[model samples]
Target: MTATAPHFEAPPVRAPRRSVQALLEARFAALLVAPAMAVIALVAFYPLGHALWLSLWKINLRFANTPWVFVGLGNYVDAITDDARWLNALRVTLTITFTSLLAEFVLGMIFALVMNQSFKGRALVRASVLIPWSLTTVVSARMWQVIYHASYGVFNRILVDIGLIDAYKPWIISPVFTIWAMIGADVWKTTPFVALLLTAGMQLIPGELYEAAAIDGATAWDRFWRITFPLLRPTMLVALLFRMIDVFRMLDLPFVLTGGGPGQATETLSLYTYRVIFTDLKFGGGSALAVLTFLMILGSAFIFIRVLGAPVAGAESER
Candidate 1:
């Protein structure tokens, strides 16, 4: 009788409630990222869009009454056919890109190999290698400009002293040598950066692989080709892509050193764009050049990724 009838109640079901703190946190995170995104859009994309818009117009800055009338690809036609300067600029630009990139890649690889070897003071050496890269591009260009001066430059003195040349030669003043001189300066300045990236990649490789290869009687070349080269491919592609982009838009060094050269010999697309915008005050034409250069760079990067077997974002994520 006593055990017969105890009243039982069901456990209460919890109700879902919105978390104010979590909502606030999400909002705060979005707020934090929004400023950076806005800045990037304004600084990078806005100008690009504006430039594209300007490119379609026929606005000459010299004419006070000139309206920005839509000219529908006229600027591009002018750039391609009517403007011989664009052709010259393209020739010089391509020459500099190919020659300088080749030299930089070779020298950077050599430097990376050297730096990868175990040695005393290696940390100090690595830090020193980065000094040039850490410096401002303009500052580095100015320093090289002094070094490349015809009469009083240390480079010329050294060349003469070493019997490389009979006397001081005007490197930046001559069209024949100006491109080469610019290439040299660019290589020296950028190779260190390339080496640093390669070195980082190399460091990620296991030392045990090399040891095992050595134990198996693999020669240095064999080990490099079999083990090191394949592993380093991704890193090399990354470095090459970055350097190639920079090379396409190179302006400061050539500008400071030669001001597009003695006879437009060092006139890269960047310098040509600058001259069109500022010197000639042809904003519309300059914008067209800018758009063309942008397209060229984007197309080149796409082609490189496809040709070089680089991993696209989706492939990389899966990996």
Candidate 2:
């Protein structure tokens, strides 16, 4: 070998101190969140994943002895293209969701404005308004069922007294009326929730802004349109999203009120899935329906996020 200079390795380049601390902090933050992430994955995602897995098989609990038959996406395809019940339920679900959402938005906005004003008995009004929302859904649904009762219902009694109808017609039994009744009940029960949300948003706004608007000669209508509504958009979107999700998966009211009856006129997607799984004992089909419903809800959340430019009520500033 010819004579050669001693080979030497270059000294290791050290990272900047601040960058090293940042990286370590990021790792520590991730470590802190890992337990909560694990809990969420275990609690929330496990059932969803299990449902997805079950949806791919033909698992008829009635015949548990038979091995699960893998049908890939057949169940989903059947629900989409073949099942008439599923189609009808989807239509009913959309109708209720849209109509109730519209009505609730309007009424809720009005109630929120009124509650935001400085007036006597304001605290009492807020409490009274929240009572409907605070009651359990099952209790509210049962209360509505009694109110729409065919024989002794207050609705029919009032209508008869006013002579709107010649006799006490069964509003809950008639196909057309049954759907409308459910929509009305849902709007009544949930509008307060929307109002509550909007009221909270309204409170966050500085009252001095309103005073300044008044000094600038902005009419009440103009102020509402310009100042109130602009700031309330995030909250409005949140309430809309929450109500949409709840109505999309509605079960108690329909179950207690119509039981998806009147010749399946009011069968919602939730009720349909329940019957498919429990009543029909077709867990696979039900799982597919459930998964489809979850996807729809997830898609709706994205639509809200994109359309409103908000991740939630408070994330608009982040955007």
Candidate 3:
């Protein structure tokens, strides 16, 4: 009741917001990602854009021409209908892609199944499998070239010993056998990769599922179909896609082994483009071929993802 002068109450003070620190953290994150973006734009996008632009021009390496005359879609037309070479190259490309993919898938699946079992020396076997895959493409091609030689080749010696052939023959020089030689080399080199991927997928499958299937008196084949196949689909698709893309762009093996020779039996789109750019000096036509090859890859990827329900690496990573 003393009625002392009411003490003036001080207004509550709010804490200052740390807006500057938040902004600095965001800036740091952006700075970290900027280098990757720059690298992608420079290495991937720049060449793609240049290739597309060059495809529209009528530029020949042999002729002296400046400003590269724009021929609109003439180059594309030449590549598609006007040239029989492109068609032949396309056929070879598809043949290699499908055939090699099929072989790799079957062999890789078998290898993966074997590796998935508990066995002795499994680590050694896995290490051995990677040796061929680790060899350089050029080295593999040269080694296979030697093996396919008409004289003093291990393959011919083995075939002769086994009574498979009457005499040694030049495998790479024959048009009929050139494609098969290329396919064999490719399969040998790449099947290990497929096995590795499939093995990884196999590891993801729960062992309990197999145990449960066994308790139900399911056979090995039944367990594989019902339990393993579904889980392995994603990885199998990934391996198939990678092999298909590589086969489509394949060049070094066929180039070195057969030189796309014996009348173009093994010539693929990549080899065709190389011939156009280097041998024929048709830069515009080569650029058009490059663009078309890129489109084919892109279109195939889109179709596989859309129709086949394949899981892309990016999508899988996001999940």
> What are the Cα lDDT values of the candidates?
0.87, 0.90, 0.89
Q: Model 1 misses residue 315 by how many Å?
A: 7.8
TM-score of each: 0.87, 0.87, 0.90
Candidate 1 local lDDT, residue 126? 90
lDDT of 3 by residue, 184-267 (tens): 999999999999999999999999999999999999999999989998998888788778889999999888888887898999
Tell me the spans in candidate 1 whose CA falls farther than 4 Å from its real position. 1-32, 311-319
lDDT computed for candidate 1: 0.87
lDDT of 2 by residue, 81-165 (tens): 9999999999999999999999999999999989988999998998899899888888888898889899999999999898899
Per-model C-alpha RMSD: 8.9, 9.8, 9.4
lDDT of 1 at 312: 52
The per-candidate count of clashes, in order, stands at 0, 0, 0
